[model samples]
Target: MYSLKLVTFVVLSSIPYFCYGAKREDFDLQKMFEDMGEEGNKMRDECFTENEMSLADLHDYDKAEDIPEKELCFYKCFFQKSYVVDKDGKVIIESIKAIEEVKDLEESDRETFTNCLKEIKPVLECKDMVEFEKCFDQILM
Candidate 1:
């Protein structure tokens, strides 16, 4: 099952890094967050509407099993903003190592998480991107 806490944690934890290493004038913190928030909300609403679920459902539980099909779409939508979202909406073995560059995770955990997902079967399919994210969340988070 996927944990939204971990999903938000890992993704939120990277905000600083995404903002840093750029020219000061080139980065507008307020505008950037505003944009992300808008995009996030738009995706969230769209997913909820399409999946026939409500955002309130997100508060209903912690387990992935409790997650509704449409709500899962939010994960895929959020991931779309980053390179982390694969073009095929599936988890990419080689591309996942990119998380290694993310300072939030330790070296040991990274390998373990990657390998664990590698062992999982349904996770290998991108037929459902949200489920793919859930698979990674179960391990990586």
Candidate 2:
């Protein structure tokens, strides 16, 4: 359950990272996830399983280099499943903002998060996870 919270935090923070000239548009985040049902949960479990990661491993990433390639891709999978990232792997900021968690953020935190998202250009590949993680830290940590 704790791992799920970690995954949720990671998703909301990094969801805005994958934009690459992709047009932003608002989406019904609640409806989107509702439609997904257990698909997201399945992906989360699969990512952890495939990466051989445990909840303990989640806290071990103190640095970008400390994150494994598999873990980075796991983030991508989460965002993709949420549709915050398109099939082409481009992030839609509006879609991210539509998320209930992101929406509920305090005003100042939301501004910081928005800025971080705009500044970071993530490719949804293993190599760029560090950049996204760095931006996420600045916003929420």
Candidate 3:
């Protein structure tokens, strides 16, 4: 469970690199939120509060190190609530592809992301998340 936190760090930490210092213009956070819709927004707010996390926390994470427990669970909560992962812990490929960040990706990059999604374990666990983090790092970082 805790190890999943590190994986979440790796996934979100990649944002800084691609977003170029986590700038809104580059990352379009507003658009991302809008894309998330009402349910997703509520989930995001709840997860942020529950985890005591903010965008700054996402920026502060170091992908080279293990992710903190709160942060990891934050991602997991967001994933589950947003239907990125189902109740049974299966990746929802379409939902992931629909994310603003994923939509902004270039065709090849999107394909790579899709491939990574396909590689995820059937039942998500900390180890699976760790592998996902590694895969995300290879693609984005």
Candidate 4:
């Protein structure tokens, strides 16, 4: 009986191993791009609507010296809002790293970094796994 049980267990384990090694098609890049685009657009629309501001309404500063203390407040608000909506963990990690990066920048550089983050916010909000993988690839690249 013990020998029969061992054989049964070995056969069952082999079945899964065979299934795991089955050939699968390569990832579809076009579908990934489409999904990313769609997720990005939806996130952008929702963010703008919730904040009651158009994308064009984001603060503009002409000089590094021109950034007021209120700009940091805006960054904090944006980070808080965006971080909570991230269903996938990738964006949250990126946002945290970006925040840390911004902390070490000069006033002017901080402004530019923050603006770049704002631009990429929609792309980071993507919750689809395929799109998330694509975004991760792009970030790493």
TM-score (all chains, Cα) for each model: 0.47, 0.61, 0.57, 0.26
Cα lDDT tens digits for candidate 1, 1-141: 123333343543432223232223323423333333444556545655655655344432244454344444544555543434555544455545544343355766666656654654442222354344444453344
User: Root-mean-square deviation of each candidate, in angstroms?
Assistant: 10.9, 10.7, 8.0, 20.5
Lowest lDDT 10-mer window, candidate 4? 24-33
Runs off by more than 4 Å, candidate 3: 1-41, 49-59, 100-104, 126-128
Off by over 4 Å in 1: 1-36, 68-70, 73-89, 93-96, 99-101, 122-141
The TM-score obtained by model 3 is 0.57
Best by lDDT: 3
**Tens-digit lDDT string for candidate 4 (1-141):** 233223222322222222122222213211221232343445444544665644444333332233233432232233334452144232444443344333454666555434443444443322222232222222222
Instruction: Give each model's clash number.
Output: 0, 0, 2, 0
Ranking by TM-score: 2, 3, 1, 4
Query: Judged by TM-score, which candidate is best?
Result: 2
Better of 3 and 4 by TM-score: 3
What is the overall TM-score of model 2 with all chains considered together? 0.61
Tens-digit lDDT track of model 3 for 9-30: 3345454343333233523532
Give lDDT: candidate 3, residue 128.
46
Q: Whole-model lDDT, candidate 3?
A: 0.56
- On a 0 to 1 TM-score scale, where does candidate 4 land against the true structure? 0.26
